[model samples]
Target: MPRTVPRLVSAIAALATVAVLAGCSTAPSRPLEGYAGEPKGVDAPASSAGGASWTAWLEDGTQFAIVLYGSSTCPPKVQNVAATADDTITATLAPAPGGICTHDIVPHTTVFSTPERITKTAEVKVVMPDTTLTLPTRQG
Candidate 1:
C-alpha cells in the first residue's frame, strides 16, 4: 500500500508536466503551412506578368499557388483558400505582418492544397479581395 503513494505522486507529476508543456506554444511559423515559395521570375516586377496577382494549379491538381505583388520584404500572403464551387476558388490573404518593406513590387507565391471540391480540369475562377482571375483549365 505504501508503494501506491509513489505511483500516485509520479502520475501527478507526469500530468503536471504535460499540462505545462501543452500550455507553452512557440511563436507562429512565418511560412504558410502546406507550401510557400518565391517562384522563378520573382525578380521581375509583378506588372511584368501584366497583372498584380494570379493563381495556378501545381503538381497535377494537388496544390494551387496564389501570387501576390507588393513589398518584396513584406508581401501579402495567402492565409487560406477554399473552393466554393467546382469551378471557383476563394483566396483570403493573411493580414499583412506590418513591418518595413521594400518599396519595390515583386511577385511572391504562396501555395495551398487544392480543396477536394475543386474541379481542376475546369476553368476555375479565383476570387480575391482585389480581383477575379479566370484560370484556364490545366493542360495535361
Candidate 2:
C-alpha cells in the first residue's frame, strides 16, 4: 500500500507538469496584410521565355514588386495589365525581339502601383509564356 501511494503521487505530478507546459505553448500568428505567396509556375517553357516570373509585396499597400526571370535572348517588357471582376490583377509580358532566346537565366525586377490598395484576400495573376499563376493575398 505504501509503495502504491508514492507511485500514484509521482504520476499526478508528471501529468500536472505536462498540462502546464501545454498551456504555455504559443498560438500561430496571423499573416501580415498584403502578404502574398512566393513565385510559382516558373518552370519549363516560361523559363525558356522571358516573362513576369514572380511577384512580391512592397512596403506600400498599393505597390508590388514583379520579378522577370527567364532565358529570353532579348529583354521582356510589360505589355498589358488588367484587373478582373474577381479581384484578380493580371499582367502580361513578352520578349521584345520576338525570336529564339538564350538558355541563360536573366532576372529583372520592377515595381508597379495599383489604382487602389489591395485588401487581404485579393488575388494576383501572373501571365507567363505558357502558364498563369493566381496567388492570394495574406489575411490578417
Candidate 3:
C-alpha cells in the first residue's frame, strides 16, 4: 500500500504540471502588430484621463500603440482599427477571453501599423470605447 501511495502521488503531480502548461498556452493573446517602442519624433498626447485609455507613437511614425490599464495578465488590447476619415480612426477591442487575470493596474499596449490614407500632418483622432484619444501632428 505504501509503494502504491507514492506512485499515485507522483502521477498526480505530473498531471498537475501538464495542466498548468496547457492552461498557459490555451488562451489567445493580443498579437503583436509592430515594434512597441516609443517614437522619437512628434507623437501622441499622453493623458491619464479616466486612468485607463491612452495612446503613443511607436516605430517612429509608422505605427502607434493604444494602451489600456487593467489586469496585467489579461490586459485588453485594440483588436481592429480603421481610418474613418483622414484624421480619424475607429478602434475596437476583442472579446475578453476567459482566464485568471492579475488584479493590478498595468498598461496593455496594442501596436498598429498606420494606414496609408490616414493623414500624418494633422491631429489624428482615435475613437475608442468611451473616449477619443488624439495624436499630435507628425513632425519631420
| CA-lDDT, candidates in order | 0.68, 0.52, 0.70
- Residue by residue across 14-118, what tens digits does model 3's lDDT show? 999998766432222243562232323534344553455777666667887777777766767678887766788788787787989878776566777876776
Worst 10 residues of 1 by lDDT: 26-35
Q: lDDT at 117 for candidate 1?
A: 65
Per-model root-mean-square deviation over C-alphas: 10.9, 15.9, 15.9
Supply the TM-score for candidate 3: 0.65
Q: Which lDDT tens digits does candidate 2 get at residues 55-80?
A: 55555445555565655455454554
Q: Which stretches of candidate 1 lie over 4 Å from their true place?
A: 1-51
Can you write out model 1's per-residue Cα lDDT over 1-140, one digit (the tens) per residue? 99999999999999999977654432222323423345543243355365367766666777766777777678778777666666877777788987777887766788677776666687989888878977668788
Among these predictions, the greatest lDDT belongs to 3
Off by over 4 Å in 2: 1-52, 98-101, 127-129
Model 2: colliding residue pairs:
73-101
Using alpha carbons, what is the TM-score of model 2?
0.47
Native-structure RMSD, model 3: 15.9
Q: Candidate 3 lDDT (Cα, whole model)? A: 0.70
Model 3 ranges off by over 4 Å = 1-46
- Assess candidate 1 and give its TM-score to the true structure: 0.64
In order of TM-score, best first, we have 3, 1, 2
